[model samples]
Target: MKKFVIFSVVFLSLILAPILFTILSPVILFSKDNVIREFEKNFNTRLPKSTVSEKIYDDYGGFHNDGMKLYKFVFTAEGKKSFVSYIQKQKSWKNLPLSQAYQALIYGGEVKDFSGNITGFGGFAKEVGLPKISKGFWKAIGDRSVVTARFIDYENLDTKTLINLKSFDFYLAIYDTEKGVLYMLKVNT
Candidate 1:
């Protein structure tokens, strides 16, 4: 009986530990202030005295119990609109104006290896929905002259059960206000 109890305890620990760790890791690692600080540190070039314009929690989808907090920043640079965000669950930092740095992490294929099963584009597309993500979606997103980006949670696609939508992978959108161009970044996560 003692041996059986010990084995069960060990098995439970092995299985549940990671699950628990994944869920709780974000709370332990990052706080709202930490995210704010990281954003300031990364985007300080444009935003010398980064001020938090807004802070709000948004549900990207129904994937995880904890949602993401979006941070908006108003930079001091002329003709430059920018912001920064952090995904608590993913523990990632993203600075805006959607530069190459942001692309590298979101769609550059590096995020997949870093976060494992947690993907940037996949989470984005799922949350934004398919109708809003058509071919010309990029143009529309860019027309706004205001660029907002965030790493919020969203639903995961069940590839095994569906085949027609198999081509669908991940979603990312960036709009250049001055250039009047919208850029879409997609990757297989």
Candidate 2:
């Protein structure tokens, strides 16, 4: 019986090895390049070919959460049309841009690895045992602009299943009478 059980365990391990590797492969090969590629793939769909009006400045780190990195971007752009369209698509995003900064953390569309989750990044948090996140902010750069935000959440897709999503990603949209630009941030916890 002992020998039979040992054989069974080894057989099960052999059978499951590839499956486990498939699931873990993303992490072993994790890189910012992958995250950026994945992000652009998803983002371009929402704001296709929105051109940048000014130079973009990016800041990244593991400061906010241990074992998790966060990315923050500050820039100017001419994506008003696309940004407004996205705001319209979001349920929690407010209609008035100057009145208030709106926010939500739902699972959003169809994530590559997570199947067809509809709720956006916030819902993903619920699935992985964290409080839902709300990441929007009032205008810091320009008082006239309303700084809106979305949690990209996909920044850490490689580790999405293993880590918390709420602390890992965010996108902020800031707009005023002159122009608009989206601030994209990614993090992990």
lDDT of each: 0.35, 0.37
TM-score of each: 0.25, 0.28
Point out where model 2 deviates above 4 Å: 1-37, 40-45, 53-78, 92-179
* Model 2 lowest lDDT segment of ten: 140-149
Evaluate residue 129 in candidate 1 and report its C-alpha lDDT on the 0 to 100 scale. Answer: 29
Please give the TM-score that candidate 2 achieves against the real structure: 0.28
* Worst 10-residue lDDT window, candidate 1: 137-146
lDDT by residue for model 1 (38-152), tens:
4434323223344433343344344432233333333344313332211212223222333322333333322333324433333332342212211211201111111221222
Per-residue error (Å), model 2, residue 153: 11
Q: How many clashing residue pairs appear in each of the predictions shown? A: 1, 12
Give candidates' CA RMSD values in order: 16.6, 17.4
